[model samples]
Target: MPAGSPKVPVKFDKVQKYFGPVKVLEQFDLDVAPGEFLVLLGASGSGKTTALRILSGLETATAGRVVIGERDVTNILPKYRDVSMVFQSYALYPHKTVAENIGFPLKVRRVAKAEMDSAIRDAASQVQLGDLLDRYPRELSGGQRQRVALARAIIRRPSVFLMDEPLSNLDAKLRGYMRAELKHMQQALGITTIYVTHDQIEAMTLAHRVAILDRGVLQQLATPAEIYNDPANLFVAQFIGSPPMNIVRGGLEGRYFLTNGARIDSPVGGHVDKAILGVRPEDCAVVAPENVALKGVIYTTELIGDHTLVTVEIGHDKLTVKASKDIHGNQGDTVGVALRREHLYVFDAASGQRIR
Candidate 1:
């Protein structure tokens, strides 16, 4: 967002969608703050794309309202809605040079020739594509093509920017580089952007707030930090983290929760009978045998470059712990693990909701 630019609010009120008899979205409600980067995250068939398509005017909702700055855009045409979209495929014209591709939108809007040239040059520079302006899409690298796509989107200077997995095709190294670049570009442009992705890391890294959906229902809408540190329910706790959280089944025993045969003080909420316990890999620590919170035998130690991922067996279940670079633990070793009590997550076994 620019220093003095006004904010644009986007809202989805009671949105619903169905494919024949199958419902893809149900009573979906979301409010995106002005200049906020909101990511819609979910697995395939989770309706994330459908939501984006609805906003893009490519798909119509069966019920509900899509609003941009208080205007009901549910029935508005994509071109008239002041929105620009960048797709995963780049979707660049094969024979058109980068400059022509970017200037197409401006030309469509009848922007004056001189103004279009200026806008195209500025957008090309903004995306570091100035040097490649004469190159056709077929002559560019994957990253270069993506930049051209981004440049085209920026040249429109629309109020809202919609991106659907714009970096899914890049290689690992390029994906990482572009992730940071995309974040920086979005911040610089200050557009009200809505990004849709199935990658949890992308959602966490790029979003001001994430809106997670599953089975057509919204599970959570919150800041990335809040969603990660304080999950609203079991699905959120399980979905937000890399390697996911360690969810162990336990029974309440004598004011403490017992996993396998090891005893640890119960988290704040428990029924003294049964509950689901969750601990992040980072929160699980290796401790002296006598001070161990749980006794488990190391089943495997996976070296993931910078850190070792140790999976320990407690009873019949396996719990993964992220070991620091300097911490050494071998496979099949009897390890004493201590789980941080304050960071423990407790959820209802039946409802899957947080108990405390």
Candidate 2:
């Protein structure tokens, strides 16, 4: 907490992983700055978990190195790596009380009885599980059980925390509450954290930086805002947003792109035969007839409290736009759609990489 305090950093150098003959990670490299909350986000089987496993020393990298605080730990044992993990399953002993579960790690390390007791109490209080310390695992709710797991992790006072979808078991509401708590706890502890999850919302809200993975490849790594606003590729754009990004198949006409037989101005000026246009739902708007760049029939409308999602049929593809409920429209009616020119994202159709 002092100004001259030392800092720790986690770095991955050209890491690769293989399960027997199948390659699961390809030259993966990443850096987690000291006291940073880094999130690894991807779909199932995207190698996010594998990367975390490698970092926690549960799984070894087939090639390259893993370092923490300037130390190469590629082949270090899990218990001696100065890292604690909170798994999706919680991994709590069903027969043990909350206090016992929280003290399990200290017990394994043969910590002094008095010191172990103090650590258990501190961890329980940190996670607000002090009141339920005597309760068995089955007596606690899903959220409480998750806290128990987190308590156990924090008690170790490890330099880094590795969490793999630790809150995935809880209900949506509980997950949201725990997310805020997790971030606050990380700040209070000032320990570097590497979180692995498939939920983009979780990554956006809790992480200082997010690494995106897909099919055993590291796609893009950036701050949440950058990844959302300036995605490096089509996959990152489509995967990071809810309802996903509105990617439409279109062709280039001069410096403009053709969208549903209408000219949508392109930010970049070169002549290309084909390309795709990506527009976030929030950036797409409904405009007056003549002001519209593209025209399409409203396929469906979903009103979710403060905003509404309108799905429109633009030629053969459907695109969604977010708008206020006051803006009235009905299904099957023709509506004018326009994209915020400056906010448009252009990507190469064939390569699926960002062109602008």
Candidate 3:
């Protein structure tokens, strides 16, 4: 989206989809503001990709409407929807040069040769592919191929950008590089973007807001920080973090979480026969095993550069503790885990719902 490129909102209103006997999206509702970067995040079979496809007119919704800006585009053909999509596959033309590939969108609409060439160069330059415009897809690296796809999408100047795991093909390092380029490019262009990915890193690093879905249902939608810090349910709490938020099966006794004969105080108060106490690895401290509520033998230790992740076996469950990088511990060493009450989360065991 260049300086005056159209910026529009997107919405999915009470959307539902089913594949014969199996339901996909159930009452899915989401609203994306104008020029906002929204990421649809979920694992495979979560229906995230299906929702995106419906919006792009590639897959028709079983029920409900898809709105782009002020128009109800549920029945519109893709080309007439005024939206651009970049798929997991780069989808570049093998026989076409980068310039020709990028300018293809305009060429279809019969833009003048001079204008098409200018637009192609502008789009290529935006993705830092200017110097390689004459190269064919075969000559470009994975990242370059991705950029060509991006440039192709850009030349359309569509009202919305739809990307489906666009960088999944690249190597890890290249993926990271492209993620940065994508964030920068999106910010520069200010296009209303709807990106779909299973990678939480991409969802966290690139989105203005994230819509987390599970089993075709939108689990939670919020800013990445909010979703990370205050997950809506047990599923979200466990799904978000790397190494993940630790779940200790327990019962609630007053303000304490009772687990394996250990009574730990928590910030939230509730009582349930079957409950779970959730805490992030970083929230627990490793200390000397002396009259502590949690004393465990070290199961394993991993030095993850910035921190040493200590896995402590407390009874039947294990808790991961983020300790100092230089911390020393061997297998079966007894240690104490000190948990701060403020960081603990309580959830219902039966429903997997967060207990306020």
Candidate 4:
């Protein structure tokens, strides 16, 4: 099939899955638009992989429905799902050459040799693996082998693509490169894709919309910016960022949030006995003692190229601040941390839900 072919949307309606008494997925519902890239992101055992497996027919849904475009595929077998899956392991046949591997799907469907060869060449060309077509999988580098797997998956021109952490095996640099390659290829193909990964970076970079799962429940589904800037709850606020959001336990008294003998101004009105205050590293700054939101001692400093990560010790907890590279600090140095009032997030301490 050619790139930019007409694609189909994928849907999961009240999908439930279980293994004995363990419920892996509970009342899951999601809709993936045609040609849109949707990422299922979560930590281990969060049901992201289970959700992908159900959609690909690798695992059956205990109840509810799975739909592909206009067809209900809730009970369909893997072979009939009309979707291509790329696994983390790169599932390439060691004995097969790159060309043979890419053409295997076509061969299985009994496509003509001429048409199969044409499709294989096209797929390999898209992934820049045409030059290594005659080479066997054992001889290729990890990235190249992954390209072969991707080429094979795309060769069939399926209506949808289901990828489960397909870039996890690669090193950091290679993974970054492959991420760009995958994103470009997916856009060029215009196929509805559902990607599963625990990597927040991957989910942020690849998805049109991200579905964040925690335990067996869907926490939030939104654009990366929305997920980062406006998290639905404490779990999402803490999980989506690099250093993660710094959450401090405190009590709300009127417009003041009190913690560790420090009182910080909050826009959230009213009072609460217990509350959770969240602020991203970039949104907090190191300021002079008198004009600060909270006062603490420097705990650690990491110079990460463009910026320096400064962690300040506050009582038993630490809050990280993304400071300028030129900023200098040492352990145990008395410092003041200032939070951007407009960027501060508040959540319910007990329920972990965002407090608007």
Best by lDDT: 3
1-356 per-residue lDDT for model 4 (tens digits): 44444788888999999999999999999988999999999999999999999898889999999999998998878898889999999999899999999999888889888888889888999999989999999899999999999999999888999999999999999999999999999998799999999999999999999999998899999999999999999999999999999989998888888999889888686678889899999999998767775899999999999999999999877999999999988899989999999999888899999887
Q: Rate the local accuracy (lDDT) of all candidates.
A: 0.88, 0.90, 0.92, 0.91
Q: Assess candidate 2 and give its TM-score to the true structure.
A: 0.96
Which stretches of model 4 miss by more than 4 angstroms?
A: 1-5
RMSD of each: 2.2, 2.3, 1.2, 1.2
On a 0 to 100 scale, what is the lDDT of residue 242 in model 3? 89
- The TM-scores, one per candidate, come to 0.95, 0.96, 0.98, 0.98
- Candidate 3 per-residue lDDT over residues 124-176, each given as its tens digit: 99899999988999999989999999999988888899999999999999999
**Candidate closer to the true structure by TM-score (higher is better), 1 or 4:** 4
Model 2 lDDT-worst window of ten: 1-10
Q: After superposition, which runs of candidate 3 have C-alpha atoms over 4 Å from their true positions?
A: 1-4
Alpha carbon deviation, residue 321, candidate 4 (Å): 0.5
User: In candidate 3, where is summed lDDT lowest over 10 consecutive residues?
Assistant: 1-10
C-alpha lDDT of residue 338 in model 4: 92
lDDT of 4 at 309: 98
Badly placed stretches (over 4 Å) of model 1 are: 1-6, 253-255
Model 2, total clashes: 0
